[model samples]
Target: MEFTQPVDSNLFDDAKVVGKPMQRIDGPLKVTGTAPYAYERNDAAPDALYGYPLGAAIGHGRITRMDAEAARSAPGVRAVVTTLEIDPLEKGINNVARLFGGAEVQHYHQAIAVVVADTFEQARAASALIEVDYEEGTPADLDLDAAFERVQGTGEPDTLVGDVEAAFRDAPHVIDQMYHTPAESHTMMEPHASTVDWSDGEEMTVWTSNQMINVNLKSIAATFGIDRERIRVESPYVGGGFGSKLWLRADAVLAALGSRAAGVPVKLALPRPMVMNNTTHRSATVQRIRLAAREDGHLTGIWHEAAAYCLPGGRGENPTAQTPIFYAGETRRVKNHVVDMPLPETADMRAPGEASGLMALEIAMDEMAEALDMDPVQFRIINDTQVDPANPDIPFSDRHFVECLERGAEAFGWSKRNTTPGEQRDGDWLIGHGVAGAYRGALVLPSGARAILDGGKLIIETDMTDIGTGSYTILAQTAAETMGMDVADVEMRLANSAFPASSGSGGQFGAPSSASGVYAACMALRDKIAGNLGIEEASFNGGRVTGGGTDMALSEINEEVSAEDAIQWGDFQKDYAMGTFGAHFVEVGVHAYTGETRVRRMLAVCDAGRIINPVTARSQVIGGMVMGVGAALSEDMALDRGRGFFANHDMANYEVAVHADIPEQEVIFLDTLDGVATPLKAKGVGELGLCGVAAAIANGLYNATGIRVRDYPLTMDKFIDRLPAV
Candidate 1:
């Protein structure tokens, strides 16, 4: 479809700032240690005091007895606030577990006490000294195999269409398998942190690192029984947050509470170790997938069931977000289930449902491809659905998934792949090529933004957090492109409570949803300028901000217009469905002797409409691909069932991909203009990168080996016994 003003098209097609790979705007500050992360902002803000949290040592248990004498008398200790001592702290909508001062032990390291101190070091040293006796309640068996026995019904228990059971029963060929994935960690460069200095006892200001700031502001106020209007939270720079920092985590709340108690502002940062247990972690899962197909290679039926662990208090929900709905199946039901384990609050991670689900589904597809004696790419091509079979009325906004699969296949030379595993041996290494198509909807939520035109400059402010995704640069490019000016002409002030509430940077919505807000506001400014020049708003249309019969500086328009005088838009999402698509191709070499696997190369063809900044978007996809590789190969947070805590609780044991682990990576964006998604005709490119990625790599590993392994991390240990004999 055509757009009134081709959304974000200039970014990909223009020579100014769109396609050109430029250095990041914040690169210098980051390299020189000039940028201030959350914990470091205390120096400039209304500085606060220091508070350190006292964690529950056991994973599941009640605090039977507590001793605070040593901690209270410790040097510089201001106040020792334990669970029973403080006033009730309300629950944050974004937070499933309470921030602090809670008696009931729901999960591991649930904060039961906070030691307020004059100095951070004192709080730290004293927090370690506090001792408590635990009832040592029996923790839930954390093993997935044992837990799924009583999984009962899948999540959202009953959603049915065609009879999957009868269809699979009548099918000519069937493949049923179970896949398991351990929980993983984010390990972002910075830990969870917050600095708080109250505006007054009833009010507070926190310098924090969280993806959603304004939402947290209200939640924090509600937690303390104060006015949301009284809180001012700001986070101009964030090191990185894959998904862990999305909500109002403990660091932000405990610090505020501690600061209130100390009567001086307080700063609290979760020590890297404490952050993992004190907050949340991705839950471990047990998944079982059953696929049935006809002799002609048509899928007759499919079933996906996934189970994950959570605290006894919280219900386990669907872990299978994206099942095989991408393909056309007459009878299919993808279900999710949660098992109660003595685990911490389980929440979202990047590419949540697709990430883990794909691990099993895609690999099974590879196995089915082998059973049918068909090319993996061709198998995907036949199953492509333009209109959702499950919900046939909703057509995709723009589906280039077929194009992605075909282009990716041609680019990766899939035809050259070795059909037989262990036969195409490169001396000691076996080479394999595999592909998996990615599907993720580009969602657009109502977003509002206000631009300030001050002194020949446009200061664009939104409550969106960058989260190391280069959001600021892309947003600036969108505004500058709309205003017909240089990117440098735009200044950004984002992730602050002072700004209007925004869609707050989750679900890969920043570039698409947030930039659309900026685009709307800029259009308003253009109209204001046109009116000032006596040109009818509609008269000065195409490529014309100020042209024939119109000449006026933007400064005059801002002077005459009030903030509310600016334009606002009505609901525009009804016209079309906006989404992003991509296909991931992975190459891997599994060692024949040692069963070691290393991802040799990877590529992704993405369609996220117009890439606002190619460099940043490429970085996002490549990073996501690497993360996908990690998920398929070597990333899982192991929980010590006996100890009732995470076994690899720290970075030393937790594995995330490093540069050394990655090979040459590539990403291609299908340039398109989608007005239905937004005025920018752009969609989110940040997240779709990892979606269906682990599946591709896992499928690739299977292609390299006849044995189809479904579980995640595709660990060699799991395959060593099944390896083919030379």
Candidate 2:
């Protein structure tokens, strides 16, 4: 079904299940520990061997010699495969670094060898017996400060709209500043793991933890130089991804190789420390923002330049991606620069570009508001634009940015906030309020699904993954709404390569795109049923089909029916600019004596089109809020520049938000729909919640202490000495 234009009448208009707050259907299995993860699939691979991987000790080097004789002779050890012994494997299409079978190490903790044994302990013990000699080389640049000087443009030098320099110079109000953000880890609950069973070198089946199952199937096939149909990938449940599991990792590749060598199925689970260094991470960024506005608080020119490090063939982080669309400016410029570094592969995490970009841009907005002596919320309202700032001809499909701000401010009691820092005090605490706007583009991809109706029960099958974002529940809701049945009556089978491919969870596009696919498949099924009954049209309600002056139970149809369909794009994306908008309001209390900041309350007003399931959408928004809090005040992956690796590579040293750290959080979704997005009229809300959240917290800290911080994590040390006297 090609979505060429706005849907005339969607099934959700009188929805009984789609918009309701429904509990997740998979919750019972997860809480009872009945769900099988990658490494715990003992029932399917009962005779599976355990594989322990050995990673490179040096970041950049060549393996001169490897001695695995002792490991081969170790007790219970079945086989030991090293990079020196195996044939060089081709890099997967979606992979930036080769998983295994290479002499030259590209980054720290690159997998070097794998030892398979009868038990996990045996494999771990045997792995330590292998010895390797490496020839180290001069490390690549690891310092963002020094690398910024040698940074090169990434493809297009800059996004130029008008005369930016002239507009900035002529503006009456101008603010310029530089901001820095450190590298971050995904810190998902489950580690990267996989279980592989190869059959006589002809076919392979892998039970793995990943986001995109089809991508994994193709990549694994490419790496093994086998037919695409020869591999089957299954990821029934994923603990969490946050973009870390979007591509093929070393766990699956090594497990497949180990299984082949040992003549038995093998399972590999990356250790805690290895998950940090061997996988991808969000790269650090250095951003410089210049805002020029008129005296009346209208923005005239906005210039954002960002530089970040990436591997030689990797994509760089673009922190200026949201600058050209956020506000109405006569002139704007955005530039992205990439610096070569010898570090772990950098990739998307959460909102990626917008997360770090807004951390700087929103703070710059707050600073400019102060320069104009105006309310920050009012300043944002004054520069609101309904059309794309870069190309005014393309208007936004549905934008409620002003409504988000006004509603959030009213709900958060913005009128009572004290504007002057250090003036409002309660005993030993200073109080302040802050606000930041959120923006993230809504993206849709080609997605397909199959629906089967058997004896009044509807079953939907797709390769979409949950990844803790409620994909299963929302898709079930879509099926239930379309079939005119309760959500409990619909069974959803997902994340299996055998199922129809879907838009696997990433970039906040999973929900809308996958659900639209389900909608199309259901529509096809409805048409088939109507044609079989010899009616021109049919209406479904209360498990009964009515058409042509006849009503009958849907289950009375003797023959089973099934249909499959896909949602393809036409020209909607090219004609209109579609994005999700939100507003974050935060209240903070600073300890006058210790200079510590504590969040008192938080609220997010989002306009992300029609929400499929409010219960799941709220959970996603709250999770993002917690992550944003960590980004603002705690999370930072310290770099060991001398060694070209992350210093705090384990969870012990890396601090994230605990239950006690988060106060009460409220999420309010605006009643909206975007016809240009899909037939479902729903957009993504996962990444939009975190877009401007960190900046709001930083702005609150500044309002409370009168000290502005341009660096991320907003650690207490950055403002301890600068805090005013009690």
Candidate 3:
């Protein structure tokens, strides 16, 4: 089914399950501790040996010597494989550093060796016995500030829409500032783990914790120099994957290599410290924003330049991506500069570019509103654009950003907020209110699914991963709604390469794209059922086909029917600039004496088209809100510049927002349906809930103490010295 035009009506229009607040069907298994994570999949490979990975000692260098004789003789140790024994492996797609093989180290914690043993403890203990010596290279380039300075006079900007400098010079109200967001870890509950079976030299099967199965299957086939069909990747249950597990990582590769070498299945799970330093992280960004506005709080031009560090030949963090189309501006300039730093690999996490970008851009918006002495929410509304600012001829398919702002302001009691800082005090606390607009472009991908109706049960099979976002529930709901059956009667088999390919749960495109695929497959099944009944057209309802004077139960057909189809989008994005928009309102209290900040309450109003399941959607929004709080006031990966590694690489040293740190959070979704988005008429809300939340908290901090700090993770020290007098 090629989606080219807007859908006027569909089976989802009168949906009974798709739009309802349905509990997760997999919740019972998860809470009962029966759902198997990758590391605990003993049933799949009961005789699997354990493998422990050894990382490089130096940040960047070549190994001079490796003495693994001791580890090879260790008790229960089966085999020890080192990088020096083999040539460098081919790099996978989107991988900046090789997973294994060769002596040269591109970054700290690069996998260099694997020790296989009878037990996990035995393998881990044996790995410590190995000795390695490295010829350390010169200190790596780990500083973002120096990189920013180096790119200042290099060349023309990456993107230049119009005369931004002239617009800034001629504008009456203008603001220029710089902001910094430090590196952050995904901190997902489950670590990177995999279990590989290669006992049969002809075929290999891997049960891993990953977000994308097909992508990993292809990567594994490429890394092993095998046919794509010879490898199978399965991830039935993933505890959580913000974006870290989107690609094939070291654990799977190490396990596969160890299994092949030892002639037995092998299981490997990266240690907590290794998960921090070895895997991908959200790169730190230094962003400079210059906003030119009119006296009426309307934006005239936006100049956003961002600099981030990455391995050579890797795409860096893009903190200026959202500046071009977010608000109304005649002239806009957005640019990104990448610095070749030999640090850990930096890649997508949660919202990725928009998360860091909005952390600075929205704060700048608040500052601009102050310059104009206008309400921040009103200022945003004044600059809302229905059409893309870069290309005004193309309008958004659907946008309700203004409604989000107005409704959020009203619900959050914006009128009660005190205009002046330090005046509205609660004894030892100073109160403040802040608001910021949220933005994330809607995305879709080609997805396919297969539906089988057998024994009065509808089964949908796809390679989509849940990742704790309720993909299973939504897909079942879609299948049930399309086939006129109860959700309980539908079975979902997901995250297996044997199933049809799906969107694979990333970039906020999983729900709509995968659900559309299921819808298409069920529509195919509906047509087949109708044709078999000898009806030109039929209305399916209550498990009966009613049309052409024929009314019969689906179960009475006596023959098993199956159909497979996919949803392929056709040039829709080219004609329409579609995005999800929201508004975040936060209330904060600052301790006047200690200068500590505490959030009082928070509210998010979102407009992301039709929500498939409000229950899971709410959970996703609140989870994003918690992560946003962590990004605002707590989470930061401390870097050891001289060593080129994350110094605080464990949970003890790293900090995240806890339950006590979060207050009351309310999420409101606007009643909206985007016909052009999909036949399901739904967009994603997972990333939108996080986009501008950190900036809202930053604005609240400023409103509380009258001190503006551009640096993120707003620790108390940043404003303690300048706090108002007690």
Candidate 4:
């Protein structure tokens, strides 16, 4: 199919800005310490009071009463605002619990009160003086395996399709295995923080670190029965949010309440220890994947059952979402079973659905390939479907999954992988290799942007957040490419509620959806300019009209671009399922004595459609892959079953892959275009790189030691007991 997307051949033929190794546009400011964060925005309020948080000591219980007598008598204490003193808080749009937990404590370290003082250290000292009496209730222990038996049905409490039972009975080769993964924390560089200054009665202005600025504005305003427009939430530069900062948290609420009570602005940021349990996290899961393949090695029945624990209202949205897209099968059923637990609720993280799903599914795929005695790449190629497997009518905008696997295999040197465990030994280590396909569904959300062209420069503004994924640069590139201007001439201002709403920065939707909004405004501007030039807009693309230098002639040909021009939904996304697909190949070596698995080399090939900025795109993929390695080999939020809480709340016990633990990494992008996606024909690459990543590494461990581990982190203790009788 011919591509309708415009090519930057004139300027980017050698891939200058499109594929060049350009530094992040905002990197200098961030490194030089000029980028202001939520709690660091000193100009938002004058002489702001310092507000320190108070967390619940119990995992789950009710606060019967609180004593602020000692705190009030403290040296620098100004005021103490608890949930009892503040206006009743409304449930946030995407939040499951109240920001300040008081009546019934939801989870460990849930917010209870804030002590306002003249100094941060002084406020922190006063916060320790508030005494809270608790009426303890037996906490619903947060173990996926313990409550899995009682919880039945899928994510919606009921799920089914086709005749999976009969198909499984009739199949020749079948594999039924259970996999377990522990809960994980976002652990972003910056903690959840906010600074609020209340002025003009109920009117409040908040500087918070949040992914969705407008959501925070509306949620914060509604919390105290105030007008939605009365509260202004500004979050222009956020440090990082791996889905942890997606919505307003306790910090914002505490700051606002403290400011009002003390009659001064208050700044509040959760301490490092408080960040672990105060915010939501990636939940633990127990998944059972049963695959039945026919004698000819074709899948007949596929059953995926996932059991996870969350608060009553918390749901793992579409946990089994990837099963429908990858392969073709007649009898298939994927279900998500959730149990109500007093543990912290699970919320969205990068690649929320597929990151954990692929950790189990793709490893199962590796087992199936071995059982069928077929090459893993060939097995994937055989089961590849061009159309959506669940619904045949919805065709992929373009599916190059087969090509990704084929090209990746050749580039990854799969022939060198011996395919035999323990036989391929390298001196002090056992070496092996494995591969898994990655899939993340494409998402298109209605978005809006406003652009202004003055003189020769173009400025685009939106409420979309960057989150350290090169959002500003890519948005600039998209607007520049569309308006046919130099990239340097384009300016971007993002993450302000005064701007129009975008899809926001969840699920890797920022690049395609927000940039598409810019495309719409640019198109309208071009059309209006053509009208003033007395020329048909359709023919204006072929030539440039020159002779207007800062005069009415230039203004005559330039059109006004506003938010209204970019708010309409288009047919670009509905006609095709615009997705990004890839595969990860891993080579690992496990220590014979210590039983430590070390990744030797890694490679990934992605079909993400016309990468707008290669530098940022490459950074995203490499960073995601590193995190995947951490998930497979080291990271785990271990629970103290006796205490009914996370034992490793700090980074000391919970381990992640360090720089020494990392391996040689490489990334590849397939060249393709999809005008149906947007004017830029690009999909989000941030989270897509992580899908199916852990499975590839886990499978590589299997190849290395012949040990089939069903639990995540692949801890040394699990294999130390079973170490081949040295």
Candidate 5:
């Protein structure tokens, strides 16, 4: 099904199941602790041996000697495989650092060996016996400031548009500042885990916790130098994945090798510390933003220069791509650069670029508003652009940014906020209110699905993953609404490579793309049913078909009907600018003596097209809001510059947002639909809920305290000394 034309008056226009606040159908299993996660999948590979991985001690070095004889001779030990025993494996195209079978250590915690034993405890205890010797290399480039200067001096900017220099020079008002955000770990509930069974000769099955099934299968085949058809990956349930499990990790590869060597199935789960340095993280960034505007807060030129440290041949954080698409400006300059560093691989996390970039850009918007004596929300509304600012010929498919801001401001009582900083006090605390705008581009991918109708029950199969985002519920809704049946009659089977390929769950495209594919498949099945009943045109209702005054039950003539189809996109994506927009309002109270900030209230207004299921959509936005609070106040992967690794690797030291830290949170979704987005007229809100949340909190803190801290994770030490006198 080619999606080239805008859909008019489809079944979704009067949807019965979709767009409703339906409780997640998988909720009972999750709450009852019966959901089978990757590591707990005993049904997939029974009697699987436990495999424990050994990481390198040095940051950057070559392994000269590895003695695993002790570990091999330990109790219940099945086999021991070390990197020194085998030639280097093929580097996967999706992996920046090699997963296994490598001598040269690129970063700290690079997997060096795997110890397989009959029991997990035995495997873990035996893995500690392995000894390794390494020769260290030169120190890594861990300083972002030094790297930024080097790039500024040597390399050309990544993007340059209209004459920003002239616009800045002739502007009536200007604001320039540099902001820093430290690296952040995903810290999802689920660890990177996998179970591999190779008992069937030359054929392997891996049950892993990964976001993308097709991509993971390909990576596994490429890493082990096996045919792609020889491997099958299944992850029916994932505890959580904030873009950390988008690709294959060392756990899967190590488990496969261990199972092959031991002649039995093997399961491996990375320890918490290993999960930090061995896997991908959100790279720290140094961003310099210069905003020039007229006296009335009309933006003249926008300059955004961003740099982040990354490994050689790796793409780091792209925090400046949204500058041109976000606001209206005649002259704009956006530059992004990466400095080569011997650091752990840094990749996507949640919203990725926009999540990190808006932590600075939206705060800069607040500062510019202060300089012009204009309201922050009003300033954003004034700069809203319906078309692409860089290329004005293309208009947005559907944008409700101004409405989002207006409604959010009204709900949050923006008029009641004190315009002057440090002027509102509640008892011994200073009360302040803040707001920030949100933006995330809408994206789609070709996705396929298979629909099966057996005895009146509809079954939908796809490789789409839930990732704790309620993909199963919404997909069921789509099928039920399309077939004119209750949602309870629809069954969703997902997260298996054997199923039809889907867009997978990442980059906020999973819901829209996968749902559209299911819709296409359901439509095909409808055609088949109508044609079988000898009806020229059919009105499907109440599980029955009627046309030409003849009515018949749909299940009566069903001879095991099945249909498979995919939703392929056309050039309409390039013809219009598509994105999701939202607004965040935050209220905070700062202690007068300790400068401790506490969130008092929070509200988010989003306009991301039609909501699939409001219950699950609200949950996703609330989770993102909690993560944003952590990013603003506590989340930081402290880097050990001398050792080239994250110092606070454990959860004890690396603090996240808890229930006590969060206050009241409210989310409102504006009813809307995008004709160019999909047949469902829906977009993704998983990442849009988080885009500008941190900036709103930061701005609220600045309003509570006169001191402005340019750095992130606004700790008390950054502003304690400058607290207002009682």
Candidate 6:
């Protein structure tokens, strides 16, 4: 089913199940601990052996020698496989660093070997017996400041409109500043894990925790030089994957190889430290933003230049992606630069580019407002653009940025904020308020699904993963609404390579695309039911089909019915610039003597089109808000410059937000629909909630202390001495 034209009217208009705040269908299983994760699938692979991986010590080096004889002869050891014994595996299309089976180490903690044994402790104990020698190479660039000067432009040097330099020179007001954000770890609850079972060297099945099952299948097949159909991947439950599980990691690869070598099923779970140093992370960025505006607060020119580290044959973060679309400007330019580095490969983390990019851009917006002597919310409202600023010829499909800001301001009590910094003192604390706008492009990918009707129950099947993002509930709502049945009658089966291919879960595209696919399949099933009953017109209601003065229970007519279809996109993107918009409002209190900052309260208003399940959507948004808080105040992966490795690799040293760190949070979603987006008319809301949150906190800190910290995490040490003496 091609989604080439806008849906004039669909079953979703009078949706009975979709728009409600339905509880997650998988909640019971998760709470009861009945759902089996990758490493806990003991029922399927009861005789599975345990595999322990050994990572390299050097960041960049060639393996000089490897001796695994001791490990092979250790107690309870069944097999030992080292990188030196196997040919280098082909890199997956979506992977940056090679997973395993390589002599040349790309970064520190790169896996070098795996030891399989009868028990996990035995495998772990035996793995330490393997010895390795390495010859280190010249150290790579480790300084972000030095790398920024020599970084080369990625793709187009810059996105240009009218004369940006001239506009900036002639403008009456200008605010120019540079900002820095350090590398961040995903730190999801579940570590990278997988269990692989090979069948007589002909086929293999892997139960793994991954975001995209079909992509994992292709990657595994490519790595082993086997037919794609010879492998199967299944992941019904994932603890969390902020984007860390989107690709094939070393755990899956090592488990597959170990199972093959030992002639038994093997399971591997990456240790916490290995999960940090061996896997991908969000790259650090240095961004320079220059905003030129008039005295009346209208933006004249916007220029954003960003440079970030990138591994060889890898794409760096584009910190200027949102600059050309967020606000209106006559002349604008966006430049992205990449510097080659020998750090662990960097990839997506939640919102990715927008999350880090907006942290700088939105704070710059606040600074510009201060220069104009205007209210920050009013400044953003004045510059709201309904069309793409870089290309005015294309208009946005649906944008309510001004609405978001206005609503958020009203809800957060913007009028009560103290305009003067350090003036609203309560004992030893100073209070202030801040606001930042959010924007992230709405993306869609072709997805397919199969719907089956059997025994008075509707079943939806797809390879889409939940990833702790509520995919199961939303897809069930889609099927129930289309088929005129209760949500309880719908059974959702997902995250299996044997099922139909779906969009998978990344970049906030999972919900809408996969739901649309389910809608298409349901529509096909409706057509088939109508044709089977020999009725020209039919309506499905109360689990019965009625047409031509004849009515019958759906289950009575047929023992089983099934249909499969895919929602294919056309030229909608070329005609419409579709994106999500939101506003973040925050209140902060700063200690006058110690310069300590704490977020007092937070509120987010979003305009991302129709929300399928408000309960799950709110959970996603609030979770993003907490992550943003962490990014603004705590999360940082400190780099060891001398050795080129992340020094704080464990959870103890890497601080994240706990219950005590977060105060009150509220999330509101505007009731909207985008016809150009999809039949579901719902854009992504998860990443949009995070886009401007960090900036709002930073802006709030500035409002309370009258000091601007360009670097991220906004730690007290950065401004402690500058604060007033006790």
Q: Give the root-mean-square deviation of each candidate in angstroms.
A: 3.1, 1.3, 1.0, 3.4, 1.1, 1.3
Clashing pairs in 6: none
TM per candidate: 0.93, 0.98, 0.99, 0.93, 0.99, 0.98
Tens digits of per-residue lDDT, candidate 5, 1-726, equal: 889887766999998889999898889999999999888888877899999999888888899999999999999999999998888887775788888775899989999999999999999999999999999988776889887877753456565668899999999999999999889999999999999997554999999999999999888888888898898999999989899999899999899889999999999999988999999999999999999999988999999988987778888888886787999988888888887788889888999899989999999999999999999999999999999998899999999999999999999999998678999999989988889889998999989999998888899999999999999999999999998888878899999999999999999999999999999999998888878777789887878778977787766755899999999998867989999999999999999988889999999999989999999999999999999999999999999999998989988989889999999999999969998999999999999988899899999998988778778898999989899999
Give the TM-score (vs. native) of candidate 3: 0.99
Better candidate number, 4 or 5, judged by TM-score:
5
lDDT of 2 by residue, 1-726 (tens): 899887767779889998889999899999999989999999999989999999898888789999999999999999888999877788886688788986888888999999999999999999999999999878666779766755533456478988889999999999989899989999999999999998366789999999999889889988889998888899989999999999999999889989999989999999877889999988999988899999989999998888987788887677888888889999998888877787888888899899999999999999999999999999999999999999999999999999999999999999899799767887899887889999999999989999988988889999999999999999999988998887877999999999999989999999999999999999899889888888788998888789998798888877789999999988867888989999999998889989778888999999999999999999999999999999999999988887778879888998888888899899999959888888889999999988899999999998888989999899888988988886
How many steric overlaps are in each model, in order? 8, 0, 0, 1, 0, 0
Please estimate how well model 4 matches the true structure, expressed as its whole-model Cα lDDT: 0.78
Return model 2's CA RMSD, one decimal.
1.3
lDDT (CA) per prediction: 0.75, 0.90, 0.90, 0.78, 0.90, 0.90
Q: Where is model 3 more than 4 Å wrong at Cα?
A: none
Better of 1 and 2 by lDDT: 2
Q: Model 4: residues >4 Å from true position, as ranges?
A: 1-21, 152-161, 538-564, 571-575
Q: Where does candidate 2 clash, by residue pair?
A: none
* Per-residue lDDT of candidate 1, residues 450-530 (tens digit): 766665677787787888888788878777766666777778888899887677777787677677777667667666666
Pairs in steric clash, model 5: none
Expressed as tens digits, the lDDT of each residue in 110-180 for candidate 4 is 88999999999999999899988887777455556766655644254233557889999998889999888
Which 10 consecutive residues of model 3 have the lowest summed lDDT? Answer: 152-161
Q: Clashes in model 4: which pairs?
A: 154-336
